[model samples]
Every structure is written in C-alpha cells, then in structure tokens.
Target: MFSMDDFYKSGEVEEDGWNLMSSGGRSNHGWRSQSSVCWVGATALCLGLLLLTVIMVAHNTSAINQWDSKYTDLIHVLTKGRDELRDERDQLKIQSSNLTQELEALRSQYNDVVDSRDKLQEDIKNLHRNRTDKSCKPGWLKFNNKCYFVSPCGTSKTWEGARKDCQQKGADLVIITTRDEMDFVKSSFAITWIGLSRHEHEDKWKWVDGTFLDGDGFWQDGEPNNSDGEEDCVELSRSATAWNDVHCNQKFSWVCED
Candidate 1:
C-alpha cells in the first residue's frame, strides 16, 4: 500500500546505509548473484542427467526382452528335436523286436528241415546196404539182419513129413521168432507148412524141433484155434500174412529151411 516514490526513497536510503558498511560492498553483492545463477545451472544439469539415465534403463530393458525371446526360441527348437529323436528311437526298438522274433522262427524251421534230411539219408543208406549184401541170398527173406528160406515143396504132409523134408535140405520148417520174421515168411507168396502142431494134447501147440512154442511168433489175432477140435497143424496162407491150422494130410506147399 506504500506509494512508489516513497518506496524508491526508502530503497535509496537503505542502499546508502549498505554502502557505508565495509562487509556489504559491491563485489560481495555481485558474488551473491553469480552463486545463485550457478545453483540454477547445476539444478538444470542434474535434471538432464536424470532424464538420460531413465532413457538408458528403458533401452536396456528392451534389449533384455529381446534376448529372452531368443532364448525361448532356442529352447523350443531343442525340445522339438528331442521329441523327434525319441520317436525314432522307439521305432528302432520295435523293428529290432520284430527281427528277433522272425529270427527265432526261422531257426526252428531250419532245425526241423535238417532233422528230416538226416533221417531220409539214413533210410537211403540202409536200403543200399541191404541191396548189396550177399549173405542174404536171393529169393530168401531177410529180417533183423538174418536170412530165412521158405521151401517151395508143394505137399500136404504130416508134421513128421514136413520136418524130414526140411532136414534133408539142410534147413527146417520156418521157426518164426518175431513179427519181422513172420512177415518175411508170409511174403514168400507160397502156402507152406510150418512147425506148429498139436500132437498129443488139445489146445496146445508144439514145434517140429521138439521145443515148446515158448516166446515164438504167433499170427496176428492168434491162430491154430483148432476150431471144432479137428484141425491140428498150422500152415502159412499164400494170400496174406496169416496162419491157419488145417488137416495134416491136406495137400499144400511145404516150407523148408536153410
């Protein structure tokens, strides 16, 4: 509310009072102004430096984000590769298992074939050996590595008559000991007299060699049943490997031994 002129006059008086003091000289006043200017400049510079720091921090944050993205991409690629590799390994394991099974099956088949081949070869060798052997005379049957001769002498004779005929020819009526011998004698295609007969007893058979018919070969299903208790001597049939007990005087081919 003071007037301008009064304020101006009061300021002149205050300046005069300050001039009178040695401490409040003109140089000191100029220094105060300069210090204030310097403070203002320093404050502005600090504000600018703070702004620059903020910008640098933002740029660095952006770079870090980019690096993180790159790392994520690399991880994704590696994971995908790992998955593919696992799939391939699984496939290979399956194939290997299949191959192993196939190999075992093939090995079993091969073993069977080899065994069959060996058996066939053995049979062929035995046949060849039998064909070349001289001890088995021609027209004579061989069985169990032994030779048998069935006489072709056609006659229906008594048990004594058949025995005498075989002895004169250095052989006896067929004395079969096994199925093989029985089969061989029957294959001769001649109805011949054998050594089996019931002489003094009924339902009992004896051999012409005077030996009891113990453990000797009998016809299949058992023969010399002596049906009606009349037939007593056994003879081989020409049609099959069977025996029949007929009358001792019946006319039939006789069997000699050698």
Candidate 2:
C-alpha cells in the first residue's frame, strides 16, 4: 500500500546503527586503559615488598654472625682457663708428694738420733751401775773404787806398825796416784803414815807393795830434804802435797786401804 514511505524509514534506522557502533568503540578503549593502570600498580607493590624482605634478611644475618663470634670467643677463654687450672692442680699434687717424702726422711733421721741418744744413755747408766756395785768395808771411806781407813783419834802407830796392822786385814797403806786421792788423804788425815819409805837407799823412796817411787812422792815444798839421815820413813804432811820425811820410830795416825 505505502511502500515508498516505509523504505525511506528503514534507510534512517541504518544511519543510527553507525552512531551506536562509534559509541561502543570509545567505551571499550576506556575499560582497557583502566585495567592496564591497575596491573602496573600491583607489580610495583610486589617489587617493594621483595626489596624490604632482602634488607631485613641481610641485617639479621650480620647480627647472627656477630653473636656466633662472641660465643666462640667465650668458649675459647673458658677452655684456656680450665687448662691453666688443671696445670696448677697437677703442680700442687707433685708438691704434696715431695713434702710427704721429705717428712718421712726427717722422721727417719729423728728416729736414728733418738736411737743414738738412748744407746749413749744406756752405756752411761751401765758404767755408773758398775761403779756403784762396789762396796767399802766397815769403817772405811770409798773413793774411785778404793777404800781408805783413817785411824780414830787417840790411836797412833809407827809407819811399820801401821803397815803391819793394815796387812793383818786384806788392805795396805794407801798409795796415792792422783791429786784427787792425795787431796782426799790430806783432808782425812792431817799428818799420817803413808806407804813411802827409803829402805833401798837413803834418799830413794819405795812403796810398801814393793813398787819403787818412780816420781817424787807427794811431798811438801822443799820437804823430804833429809833433815837428818835418820828420816828414812815418810809420813803424810798437813800440806796438800801430803808427804814429809820422818824418823822411822815416829808415831802418827796412819791410813789403811781395802
């Protein structure tokens, strides 16, 4: 019926379709640009996170290495100290052993010294005991294991009579050989008869036991000068020298020894 008018409207609708195509092309280009910006931002964020992690790891590694070095040094120091202490302990043990040995040696020496002292003391005791074992007869004084009998007061005799009286007993007139004995005899008897006589020669003295007077009899100073030729017998003087020449018949107290 109206074919010509409808065909003209269809041509106008086709022109509007070109306009819609151009609007769609502009929308697509805007969306692609927004996606590209989002991707670039995400990539930059990841790269920053990686860089920070690397810095932290490097710092921690340096700190760990420092700690390890300190620990190693401490261990070395402790080990050295321990070794030194061990050495000192060993030295002390050695010293202790040496001291013990020295103490033992000293003890042995002390024991030896004690033994020597005991032996000496025993010997001395034995000597004194032997001397003490001797006893003097009645009415006699003892000196150096010898017995002496000093005549009592109011008793006097000639030298020959005294010697005979002593011979009746198992004793003789005391023959003094030491100064101590002479002193003892002098102390006991002021002037007494001894064993000295000049029976062989006028001036040569002899003992009653038949022994010659080799040395000078214990005479007083300048005594026995043969005051007279009759002075052949000898008597103890009051002087410490203990001898004086006297006549044979002179009577004086005499000494007897047993």
Candidate 3:
C-alpha cells in the first residue's frame, strides 16, 4: 500500500502496478465500470418487463379457456333440452292421434246401438199391435186385436162422408192389411168402401193412416184401370173377384175399425 503522494512522485512504474499518476487513465476505468453497471440494470429491467408480459398472457389464456369450456357445456345442455322437448311433442301428437281413433270407434259403436234400439222398438210395437184382447165396444165385432162396425143398410155415403162419420164414432175406415183381413171383410160384407184410397195425382194407393199398400193388393182382374181417370176410391165389388176402384164421390156403405 503506497501513499498517493509516493505514487505521484514515481515517474515510471512496473507493468503489474497501477498508474495512479495519470488522471486520464483512472477516469477512463471509472467510466467503463459505470457503463457496465448501467448495462446490467437495463438488461434486468428488460427481463422483468418480458416476464410480466408472459404472466399476463398466461392469465388471459387461462380465462379464455375457462370461458370456452363453459360455452361448450351450455351448448350441450341447450341441445339436450331441445331434443327432450321434441320427443315430448312427438309423444303428445301420438297420444292425440290415438284418442281421435278411439273417439271415432266409440261414435261408430254408439250409432250401431242406436240403430239396434230403434229396430227393437219397431219390433215391439208390431208385436203389441198383433196381440189379441177383449177390449171391444158394443155392436162391434172382435177380430184378433181389433173391433169393426158395419154401416146399416141404406146408410150409404160418399167415401169422404164415410170417413168423417167413422172419425166421429172414435173409429176409422177398415184397413185390410193382411190376406186374412181382406178375406174376412169380403165374406162379411156384400159390397162396401174400404179404408184404402188415393188421389188422382198419385200413382199408388195409400191407406187412411198414410201408409201405402204393400203388394198389388186384392184388385179385381183388370180393375183399377182408372177407366174414367176419376176412380180413386177402393171398394169390395158385389160380383167381382176381390176389390175394385170406384169414384170417391159415389155413395156406398162402409166398415169402420175401432
């Protein structure tokens, strides 16, 4: 350790010894040390900034990945919900179709039942009508389920007048609906007007009750020819085979059914 004054006093020093006398060299060395320190500080600052940038990028990437995962999960959930709703809608449509078919079948069955009931009622009415009973009034002949009265001799009247009189007596003109009925009426009467008649404009004969005659009816041969086009009333001819058509306005005895 030499003193500063001693180093300055020495003119030339060895190569390994420091030159403390030249102020320029000392200043140059000091400047080089300071520059190295500044360079190291700058490099550290740059490295710190780079590291901060890396951390920030990593954080943002993590946030973005989390958000993407959540979005994927939401999409899956929504798609599943939509599928379930579609399936439910399909099931409801199937149920509605089945119900419609069942309703149609029920309606068809109901119609069948109604038709059967109507037919049964008609059969019952016919059966009741044909049953025999003893509910005939005086001066009336009982036959099967009905009773009949014969107009006295010379009590002839037009077909319309005969029907009106029968109505007044709580009765109607005799309607020979069956073969047996026609035969009985023919045997019981000499010649009389019956309940069957039709208008000149009609093509067929109809009973007083508004029912049409079923068959050709017991018409006399070549009878009902409407010879005068005015013969619309029916009568049991005295000498003819079964029945004949005559003028409705003609006067004749008639039978009544009660």
Top-lDDT structure, candidate number: 3
Per-model TM-score versus the true fold: 0.40, 0.48, 0.53
1 or 2: which has the higher lDDT? 2
Tens digits of per-residue lDDT, candidate 2, 76-132, equal 999999999999999999999999999999999999999999999999999889778
Query: By the TM-score metric, which is better: model 1 or model 3?
Result: 3
Local distance difference test, candidate 2: 0.85
- Badly placed stretches (over 4 Å) of model 3 are 1-134, 200-203, 238-241
* Tens-place lDDT digits, model 1, residues 47-159: 99999999999999999999999999999999999999999999999999999999999999999999999999999998879755636557665565655665554435666
Q: Relative to the unseen true structure, what is the C-alpha lDDT of residue 33 in candidate 1, on a scale of 0 to 100?
A: 96
Residues forming the 10-long window of minimal summed lDDT in candidate 2: 199-208
- The runs of at least 3 residues in candidate 2 whose Cα sits more than 4 Å from the true structure, single-residue gaps closed, are 1-132, 200-203
- List the candidate numbers ranked by lDDT, top first: 3, 2, 1
Q: After superposition, how far is residue 134 of candidate 2 from its true place, in Å?
A: 1.2
- Give the lowest summed-lDDT range of ten residues in model 1: 147-156
Off by over 4 Å in 1: 1-147, 153-159, 215-217, 220-222
